[model samples]
Target: MAKTFASVGDLAEKTISFTELGPGLHAFTAEGDPNTGVIVGDDAVMIVDAQATPVMAQKVIERVRSVTDKPIKYVVLSHYHAVRVLGASAYGASEIIASEKCRAMIHERGQEDWESEYGRFPRLFEAADSIPGLTWPTMTFERRMTVYLGSRRVDLMHLGRAHTAGDIVAWVPDAGVMFSGDIVEYRSACYCGDAHFGDWPATLDAIAALRPKALSPGRGDALIGEAKVAEAIALTRDFLTSTYAPVAAVAARGGSLKEAWEACRAACDPKFADYAIYEHCLPFNVARAYDEALGIDTPRIWTAARDREMWAALQG
Candidate 1:
């Protein structure tokens, strides 16, 4: 039988958890779904990676309200993915911030991504119509930008490309907590549909240099303490290398995409088979790795039509 496209069959809702990593740093994780980070500063709050839709964001808002009544002053986009940014309206944040590359991607492929993602994971797009168009960043920075809410210093830095060309992480220096958005996923498959396979390992090295005490990853449970943080980073690195290495080798040899996919599945399934979204992400991940290995630097834009075509060719 042919495989389902993306996460179409993933209908069950995940349990939500608001875990405190530091004094004022929190991680809003929903099982294996996309995670959001909350940093409560003295005067205000900053939200990392908004949910998929306004309705879904409301849950985060409710959780935010539970602990700190401080206004949500900023909503940060870790990258330009529809599931991560379309919920900006619900926060009513004074500023929506993103990396300059992310803003450019929003302008380039935001609409197509919205259509493609919504079609793939219907459960994540609850009340999809509630999203007020594509989320745009009010402020964009190049390498690094720092925002201070009183004495708390939150650094938004683009630590090389991994998940996307625009991927950034929210680093709280004083608290030693890093909100690694899609750049480092723990117990979850790295979605490499629009990823930079060649640059990803070096990026992970940069993250390791930080030596964060606690790390809130893009998905899965929050990593608290130095050991867990290191473990998660290593696991993420292994997933990326394991998935891309075999696929890239096959592609470099002028193998067919189907052959590359089979090679990737064999290489990655032994360890990552039980990880979240492993099955859903494998096809797209292998396809992108194959392209990258064949010398495509920039990721091709994925539309609904392209998604179907790729899935059919790979799984049919």
Candidate 2:
């Protein structure tokens, strides 16, 4: 039988936690599962990264209810991912926000990605049927957009592509906090199937420039203080670098995928072997790194079929 995680089992429907990172800004994390950030301003609230389904999003809604009753006026999608955007409709926000490139990705491969993701991780999509359809953003920005929640300013900036082609971060300057989407995961898989490995480092540099006092990453626990925040950032960067370097080296030498997989395992399994979903992520990560090292700019599409084929080929 396939192994299941306790966190995944707990998140069967949805789980919620309310951590007050800033005065009115709450992190609605889901039992160590994918997290959602809630920012309450003077006039309205903004939800960062909707859960996988409307039913799933309701869990966040219930948590948000515990803290503030302000109407959710904006649903901001950090990027174009089914698990992140599919729950957007439940927000009933006046506007849905995303980067213009995010919209284009949804237009191009939303359906494929939806199918691919649901298949790869069935546990994360417990209420998959409740998803109305591909979530589309009503408002799209090019580089950045600033919205005011009363007097507080929320800056949404596209800090170059790492996790996806249109990845963005939510920066609350006054609070010195950043919601980094999947651009910075803690003790979890980087999900590089749709990532740009070559550009990810520079993207991390942009995030580090903010010197956030706290950060809510895509997975694991939230980074509380400045030192822990930097620790999380550095750990995520190390995870990516350690995993990629060996794969890139083997690829550069014209080694086969199997050889490259062994190389990556030798390099990363020693350090990040205990991390969550390391096995599940390594094949995809190596495949992308292999492509990039060979000068492939765009990542190859991942389907349910491709996932198994790559895993089998690389594992054996």
Candidate 3:
């Protein structure tokens, strides 16, 4: 039997855990689901990566309210994925911030991504009808921008491209904590549909140089110590290399995408088979790696039709 497209068959809701990594730094993780980071500054709060819709984001807001009554001042988009950014309205944040390239991506493929992702992950898009429309960043920066929540410094930096061309990390220097968006996933399969495989390892190296005491990854549990932080980063690196290398090799030999997919599955499944979204991400990841190896620097847009077409070809 053919597999469902993306995460269509994944309907079970995950248990949510809000963990405190530092004094006011928190990670809201949901059992390998997309995680959200909260930074409570002296006066206000900032949310990194909004949920899929307003209804879903309300749950996050409720959690934020439990800790501090300060208004949510900023909503940051780690990248322009529909599941990450469409919930901006729920926060009612004064400023919605993202990298300049991220904003451009929203303009370029936001609608198509919204359609594609919703079809793949229906559970994540609860109350899909509640979504007003595409989320737009009110403010955009080039490389790095620092926002002071009272006296605390929160640095938002684009640490090169990994997950997407516009991926950004939220660094809290004083606490030695980092909120790495989708750039790093701990025990969770890296979603490489829109990824830049060639540049990803270097991006992971940039994250390692920070030596964060606690790091909140895009998925899975929060890494709370130096050892755990290092482990998560290394695991993420190994995953990227293992997944891309075999597929790239196949493509280099002018192999078909199906052959590349099979090669990637063979290479990655031994270790990553039990990881969350491993099956869902494999086909797309291999497809992207295949394209990148064949000299396509920019990723092609994935519409809902393209998603099913690719999945059918690979899984059939």
Candidate 4:
């Protein structure tokens, strides 16, 4: 029998966690599902990376109500991915924010990405019809910006590009915590469909420079201590290098995408086979790496048809 494509086979729901890293700072994690970061301030709350749909995002809202009755004031987008941003409506916040480039990417490829991702795994978009089209940032920044949920200062910066060209991290200086979107995943696979393999490490370095005491990574459980935080960063870098190295080597020798896929599996499966969405991410990761190795600077847009074509050709 043939294997299921992307996350179509992943139907089993994961256990969710709402962990506090500091006073009023919480991370909403669902096993290895997409994680949401919460910052409850003196007057209101700010949500980092809205869930995939209004229905799905309601879960996060419920958790926020458990801790505070304050209204959600801002929605900070870490990057432009359908799984992360499509749930903005549920927040009912005054401002929806993201980097300017992220907003452009949404205009450029958001529809196709939405179609591509929704097709990949309908489970994430729990109530697809509930999504009010693509989520847009009512506010945008170029490199750095800050939001004050009252006296609390939350710094949002586009440290460097890793997961996506416009990826940003939300930093809370007083609490020493950062909500690193997919740029830093925990035990989950880094979905590299739009990743920049060559530039990922420096982005990781920029993140390490902040010396965060804790992090709510894109997926997996929250990292609570500096040591655990360091481990997560290190492991994320390892996962990226281990994946890119073998695939790049194959492409350097003029190998085919299929060859690159096989090479990447051999090198990474041993170490990352158990990771959440590992199987789903491998094909996209290899394709992007192969393109980057051949001097492709920008990642090609992924559409639903293109996704099917790539998966069928790679047989991944």
Candidate 5:
């Protein structure tokens, strides 16, 4: 390995913000770090995505305590990523819910993902020793599931494959709000290391059809208006398209991976150079785009060693 990940030396902590989206829905955002959604109900609360570790998750618990005294009885996982799902133990939620595919992925490559992400995100997993093991869902669903928190109804649905093959979004019909897990991002670069680029656009359309009045994205700030929601969704689409188009063109012409990386940078740097995680996410995104363009239907698993090898090959 000739080069290290950009996140390795990022020791500075971000200022966390707890934003209220609606009556009881809130979002916990930290600059470009992963965000968590909060859903308070008549009976208890439901956490959308757990942070990277139990100690890291304590920040979210403190924020939740400030708002409601209701116990968090449900832990909902949006995807199987280690940085998102590994903090379930801190919540002590009775029922941890996720999609069937999400659980399958956890069983398949969750450990490798844990190692891969821990090296990539040194700051996010500072308390890596506190994590017990991989997180598994207590409750798994196929297409959609409806859970009633007393009078409020929250619908968890697998809209489509965007960020990962098994990503779910939580919709609160009464509040007209959606907690879109990495499926949507606002002013932040979407991580595509384990993504489905070909199927991501259609998934964005599905999110658009929801017509959410407010949304809690996976990163950046909380969207609190219809126009802002639309803008975020559109920008997310643009980010995806801008990233894949040039790489696809390069791949079709039998170009090298370095050539594809340069093409992606030339196309994306003008518009998204300043976005959060742009440098950290670009190499992985370019690699995935190059693979998808070459008819690789599934994204290859990323291990700690593979991350170093790929980084050296592309970025060195």
Candidate 6:
């Protein structure tokens, strides 16, 4: 068994953490891999961000079953990333929910993303053959959607564009717990292949304003206390700022994409040296940052071939 996947620079192991965020909410975080949130309600359960494969999702399902026997009635996708939604079928949720923009993104480039991510990190896509097909949302909303699990209210809000144009945050008001998809990561590389680098900070500000007592970020350990929650958000903000600022500055000075990539690497390498997937993510992150810094708000599509070309260009 391949216990870990470290690409010369990434320092994180494939570790999973099951945290009790509140009375009936939990977070399953796996280093820098996609995290899954569990909400146990009076009638059933709701899961946020299924893993990349049915086999991998079963690990999350096992943990959920350890806590509650309630059937999973809802599976909320934070975005259209293949690693985040490919395992939706495993949850068997009655409704698969996402933002309208997210659904549209899925319709637009979901297949290409699947191939792109599988190529970039094969270890994360274990049991790839088990994926039935491209996962689609059964229900989608333009702005906000309030889902009730019996009497408990779970509000899914599209705060703003950060990681992607359709990123959504799941807020359990009663629990004071927020499940921030890839919008926030704790000591994890912020993958920016399809990111809005310029607008990402504003999105983080919206999340910080929530003052969550506990937060389940996309990676690393779940934040249990208010202090830790703030730290996670702060760390994520710092990482994004450090990664984009220098690259943008270089781009403004008529520097080439390759130069901007090196600048980004030089500036961020020391700051985020200990962060997870720092190496594997920086090449893609820098490429997007360079583009967004030049006023390209919407990120370019990243197919498997494009990913390799970008990586090779930025790397050399």
Against the unseen true structure, what C-alpha lDDT does each candidate score?
0.94, 0.84, 0.93, 0.93, 0.92, 0.87
* Range of the 10 consecutive residues with the lowest summed lDDT in candidate 1: 1-10
Residue pairs of candidate 3 with colliding backbone atoms: none
In the range 1-316, model 3's lDDT, one tens digit per residue, is 2256778889998999999999989999999999999999999999999999999999899989889999999999999999898888999899999999999999999999999999888999999999999999999999999999999899999989999999999999999999999999999999999999889999999999999999999999999998999999899999999988999899988899999988988888899999998888888899999999999999999999999899889976
Clash pairs, candidate 2, are none
lDDT digits (tens) for residues 1-316 of candidate 4: 1288898877888888999999999999998899999999999999999989999999999999999999999999999999999999999999999999999999999999999999998889998899999898999999999888889999999988899999999999999999999999899999999999889999999999999999999999999999999999999999999999999999999999999999999999889999988999999999999999999999999999999999999884
TM per candidate: 0.99, 0.94, 0.99, 0.98, 0.98, 0.95
In candidate 3, position 211 carries an lDDT of: 93
Question: Residue-wise lDDT of candidate 5 within 47-154, one digit each (tens)?
Answer: 999999999899999999999999999999999999898988999899999999999999989999999998988899967899999998999999999998889999
Which lDDT value does model 6 have at 87? 91
Model 5 C-alpha lDDT versus the unseen true structure: 0.92
Best by lDDT: 1
For candidate 2, the TM-score is 0.94
Least accurate 10 contiguous residues by lDDT in model 3:
1-10
Please provide, for model 1 over 212-301, each residue's C-alpha lDDT reduced to its tens digit, 9 standing for 90 to 100.
Answer: 999999999999999999899899999999998999899888899999988988888899899998988898898899999988999999
Number of clashes found in candidate 3: 0
Candidate 6 lDDT at 199 equals: 83
Q: List the residue pairs that clash in candidate 6.
A: none
In model 6, which range of ten residues has the least summed lDDT? 1-10
Candidate 1 segments whose C-alpha is farther than 4 A from its true place: none
Query: Candidate 5: lDDT of 54?
Result: 95
lDDT of residue 173 for candidate 2: 96
